[model samples]
Target chain A: MADEVKLFRTWSSPFALRIVWALKLKGIEFETIFEDLANKSSLLLQNNPVHKKVPVLVHNGKSVCESFVILEYIDETWTNGLPLLPKDPYERAEARFWAKFSDEKLWLSARGILFGVETEQAEARLQAIQNLQYLEEQLKGRKFFAGETIGFLDLAVGWMANLLSVLEEITGYVLIEEVKFPLLWKWMQDFSDVPVINESWPSRDKLVIKFQTMRDSYLAGKI
Target chain B: MADEVKLFRTWSSPFALRIVWALKLKGIEFETIFEDLANKSSLLLQNNPVHKKVPVLVHNGKSVCESFVILEYIDETWTNGLPLLPKDPYERAEARFWAKFSDEKLWLSARGILFGVETEQAEARLQAIQNLQYLEEQLKGRKFFAGETIGFLDLAVGWMANLLSVLEEITGYVLIEEVKFPLLWKWMQDFSDVPVINESWPSRDKLVIKFQTMRDSYLAGKI
Candidate 1:
């Protein structure tokens, strides 16, 4: 098709990294344009006028916004590659369900613990632990959330492997501890072992400094 | 492989209607179980342990939660009748982008106007109007959001046709007026004329009564 694939992304964005991992896993070559979210570029604005967020995958001049939507687009377009989702309709639906859960519940609950006010932080910690417990039960006897090998569900939840540790450093609130969620804790370890993911994940120290400053500003009411 | 199709839905839920319309559009026969959300059935709790919400499409045995996800699943599972999404990748992404916007932005904005407190209602009205303006622009040259047919984006935004009018009667605010959003006003008329949609849509009078009571409860701080 000769489509010039380009990705508009920002550093330290877990959403953007999901696309990066998807493209890498599918062996697609794409040009990455780092956008300054503080002062968003004209390209990002034109591509995603609605959200004005990053991780816009531009293929042949058309852009696909939203992380999970982009992953579906990639998988569909590059049908020749290792399938991101399972072939069975039921299994595919389950994978989509978990991917959405990872976005709506897992990410939001974790955010509450990291930067929420005092009461919010307490409630969020309880909810986060509850969500993780459910996930741990689902992960029983499975190597990954997707099972057997890394795929859509694995990529969707993979942010937990890196971001959870970074948040622990920034907020001193430990999650994925072996005592509470042994299965998910092990799953995180197995998720990171994949070469593409291990090589491309952001540095923990860098993320810590960034999130620490962000949390401080949030508490100070500067942002 | 004769697969049995079943849908767990609530009569008053616009979300569940989306799945209903989707199945009817594809000519797929299914059984509907009306759920009492106040006292949820064990089937709903067991199938959708996470959200416990309705519009869970159970095909054969597995259930798919989330209305938009269920629509995609139905489209993929039954590849007959009419296609929900366009075949082109870019067009499909655009369809998904709008479908998500209908959820994240439009629904919340409309809710803000309908049920928000004094100050919130004013702000929500402005946001809701602005969102309608954007959609109006998108619909300037198109009969439907998905072009000539009632497809994914149409189902996603169909709530505006029924719910918007109900909210207007409850709150005395008129949206999608011909003067303000001419294209959307016309699109609303065009959308309802579709035999499948018109036949299955809930009666406006009944919905008005339901929402009026609900809004009173909300304003009285009883909800």
Candidate 2:
């Protein structure tokens, strides 16, 4: 294809995985440039000077950085592809609200385990689960965030479900449970069962080892 | 017009101004519903149950909450207008980067006055100025956030500039000075000078009094 699209990514990064999932769902063929986190490429640095982070998508040599923004770009560019954003403006805004909230609250909660060392830090992890009660509240009756279809908000909130168990195992605390957060528990199943998402996802066995390894290295001060 | 739009806003809110500016730029006619913060309507609560915040854009009986999300909705629905998002995906991503950063760091710094007492708040104000240094560094050779034309990022970041001066005036610490943050200061002036923005902006004098009054009320435990 003359319309060459290239993606730069580092494995074991949920932020990077967001873009990867979108690309796979869209079924867009492109070159994948797996970046060395330790020794970052000049192209990655040049393309994304502000963040200089992974999952920079380059289409025809023009780059789109930031996973959420990149997701929006890919959705906008490929008209005939699977629509990532909702068609209704209000629904789109609601999806974005959850997206922003995901960045604001959920992901940060997951990061708690990565840096949790103190008693307060460990307690903070529990408090984060309490903070995520809002998700259960939001999911009360909606089949999906945008109603009966997986959309951007679903993808975003789904990241929490994928990471929570691994995060709990690493941090030595059980947070989300089917017995407690039934709606969110069901959300985990609903999201993971999406065929496209299922195909695109790294195996849980694979992620558990990867995340656990990274967490161990980080905790041991070897990272 | 059967396809109607309504904006519920507070007089002293930067978030509200964003919607006002967007509608004015698009030449869209809509009913302005100014809500008294002291006496919020049931409709406002019903429309935005999550945050219950103003600056909600009600279009054709559908409600869109959050200013940035509203901006996106506005852009998508009304196409025969000056665009807020850059046409190019890369540029749009860059715009989003700055926009998100503005919301995170800049707003955190600007809203310092809301938290602590005087001296602490002054540094909180200073932190906002320091936050702009990174922005200044980025704008070293550029005119606007995404290059020549004012785009989405410009609107978000410019909100910081408007509020910075207001916060400074109320807190007795000037944040933006011509000599220190020249680029940001000049850019703010350039931004407000534009006919659409200039016409739509609330008067500075009015905001200064309103901010000071609000601050005093908070300190007096009247809030």
Candidate 3:
């Protein structure tokens, strides 16, 4: 493996997990370096100075930061493997839109539930419900964000598989329950069942514990 | 000019503005089709059913959504023009990194400041200042986000030129003044002065009144 790939990542980071999933799907074996968020390395800062966050893919000593960008780089650099983006120009643009949508729409829905000191818990619930409603409407007749197979949106939103539980655990609410958001519920089950994804995902229990710690710290004015 | 390119855009949207800059820089004459957000056309919905957002570039009947994705499509289709993205693989990847940096980092900063509720105004300012500090560090000695010339990053963050005044008019906070964010302040000047950008920009007075009306409407509980 002379052309080995290396990554600087964080275990609970959805961004980092997305990269891990891509690497696994491609069957590319690479070395992983996990950084403790509380005590990050100088190298991580150097690699991603603007954001200084995780999931930096260093391919052949060159670094590509940002998870989605890393995904595109991964696709472009490797010509033969499973292509994450589509071949059609419009289709590729559509994939990128959903990937962007996953963050802008879904995260707001989830984050509205997760953080906020002044907003009523009921308002957060209402916000989260509205978000899920919109998502459910979008997923009404589609198997995935794209037509058939999992594409960028799946990777973009797949973090919900791990982090949704953390929000539920903290707030004592289940936003993705089968009764309320059946499409999202069903999609999660199918997405996680993908063989590569099933094998590559980090421990759910560990992520919950980590999210709890972060929440506790935020509440205690420690973050 | 039957085969002229077409653009679906709004005045305030940075993403759409990016397409304008690219097309203008390349000396391509395009028919601008402005979309009314309040009453979106069936065509806009059909073109980008996923996001239902603007800056959708229609070339020869096919549409491309998302500014970064559209930039790529423009580069690929208009191969003979002044390149927005670099040609080399490594350099291209890095250009993408910064472009993603604009979307991932700078955008959040611009958004929170522009759209945050009144009580969250302070937090929005904090995010803006933090983002500017990060940019200063990233662009420490480098002339532009892309070393020598105005590249993708410049276009990516160019919306701040239109957005700065709107945020100021709405919140009465000046984040991009000459003394406070000198580099970024100069950046606005540098970005706006290019003949292509200067000629293609939305009238600042029109944009100010639009933001004022929008802000008044938001305060009046219409939005």
Candidate 4:
């Protein structure tokens, strides 16, 4: 039987975009079911009861939740494309490590800068910059986090290329100055230049407005 | 060159124990270098500069830092073993999701209960139990999380079998009662019964003393 791929996602989620980019990169056809996260569909609720989050990939009736997990699934299931992860065990571990680091540490630090209380923003910004420095070091002498090609780590950290800028604009906090994180700044440009990624991002204007409203809500203690 | 596997770990850490269980499960010969976490060896600091935590597996000269990442490394490098992750992409995704869920959500909830401030303990206990209920449901018909054999998810959550009880004892809050979570409770027994797992665990008495001191330090605002 031919594979039937469907993605449950919101329009603006970077997590969902990771799967979209992976599918596009792999040249796989998929149905994108845009979800209103405020009122999530029963399909998403059923597929991802634990998190009830977006970027749930349903393939051949089996559902894969979690973006990184879905990315690995997409790579494993669609072997015709350039491999997302390296074949060597050590290299694969390194990729997975950075991918996880990007999501958990770097992303969380960015979130702190975005949503933290006014008193805490300065400390949070410093933490985010420190985390960004790690990414800067990782990108040294490499085009992407995965090297030469845009691969798993690139997709994992891709949000920083665009969404982070929107966040910086909304919060008036410039965490990734070119002077501060030169390689990472270059990486942002390199990541956004990828045809699949460049073509797939949501409108920057829409994201800025969306994040600005969300940041306001966060500051008001409504979220 | 012959494969060289060395594990940097603290004897009492559940995270370190996960790597220990994985290596032993594969019947792979490895050198164990015990780290005094308070006064960590330069080898460990150099190997895992990011976290500077234990369960750093250095195979040949390359080091894999995170425990879950290390588990995958072990599975991929040692192909002769009964697979840590399932062969099917879908099953592998499911295992990864649950493994992540265990480490991030369930484990953090347990931590909140263990070290959270006095006023937060009640709420944290409820959250931990809610997370445990999710695990109970996942274990409905299965003997282990990966079915008849203990695999990735099993090792990911194996800490609950031993260390959770220590936390409960130290904090005086029982999170896992057989009547409340019969299946998860049984799965814990089954997980601990595995010879390698049973043999490798730190002394329960020592753990209680260690955790009690840690918990006191936490409540005393020293940690």
Question: Measured against the native two-chain assembly using Cα atoms, what DockQ does each of the candidate structures obtain, in the order listed?
Answer: 0.81, 0.59, 0.48, 0.93
Q: What would the per-residue lDDT of candidate 4 be over residues A16-62, giving only the tens digit for each residue?
A: 99999999999999999999998999999998989999989999888
Scoring the B chain of model 1 against the true B chain gives a TM-score of: 0.96
True contacts kept of each: 0.81, 0.91, 0.50, 1.00
lDDT for A116 in candidate 1 is: 85
Identify the runs in model 3 with alpha carbons over 4 angstroms from their true place.
A116-149, A169-172, A177-183, A213-223, B1-5, B25-29, B35-53, B58-64, B76-80, B103-150, B160-194, B204-223
DockQ of 2: 0.59
Q: Judging by DockQ against the true structure, name the best candidate.
A: 4
Point out where model 2 deviates above 4 Å. A34-43, A109-149, A170-187, A194-196, A199-223, B35-41, B111-150, B167-186, B209-223
- Per-residue lDDT over B101-181 for candidate 1, one digit per residue giving the tens place of the 0 to 100 score: 889888999888878867888899998898888788778679999898888999999888878988998888888899888
List the candidates' TM-scores in order.
0.95, 0.77, 0.75, 0.94
Decreasing TM-score order of the candidates: 1, 4, 2, 3
Candidate 3 chain A lDDT trough over 10 residues, lowest sum: A112-121
- Model 4: DockQ score: 0.93
List pairs with backbone clashes in candidate 1.
Answer: none
How would the candidate models be sorted by DockQ, starting from the highest? Answer: 4, 1, 2, 3
- What is the per-residue lDDT of model 1 for residues A174-217, given as tens digits with 9 covering 90 to 100? 98898878888888888898899999888788898998888888
Q: Write model 2 residue lDDT over A174-205, tens digit each, in one string.
A: 77888888888888888888887767666778
- Note the Cα lDDT for every prediction shown: 0.88, 0.78, 0.77, 0.89
Q: Report residue B109 deviation for candidate 4 (angstroms).
A: 1.9
- Clash list (residue pairs), candidate 2: none
Each candidate structure's count of clashing pairs: 0, 0, 0, 0
The CAPRI-style docking tier of model 3 reads acceptable
Interface RMSD values for the candidates, listed in order? 0.9, 1.6, 1.6, 0.4
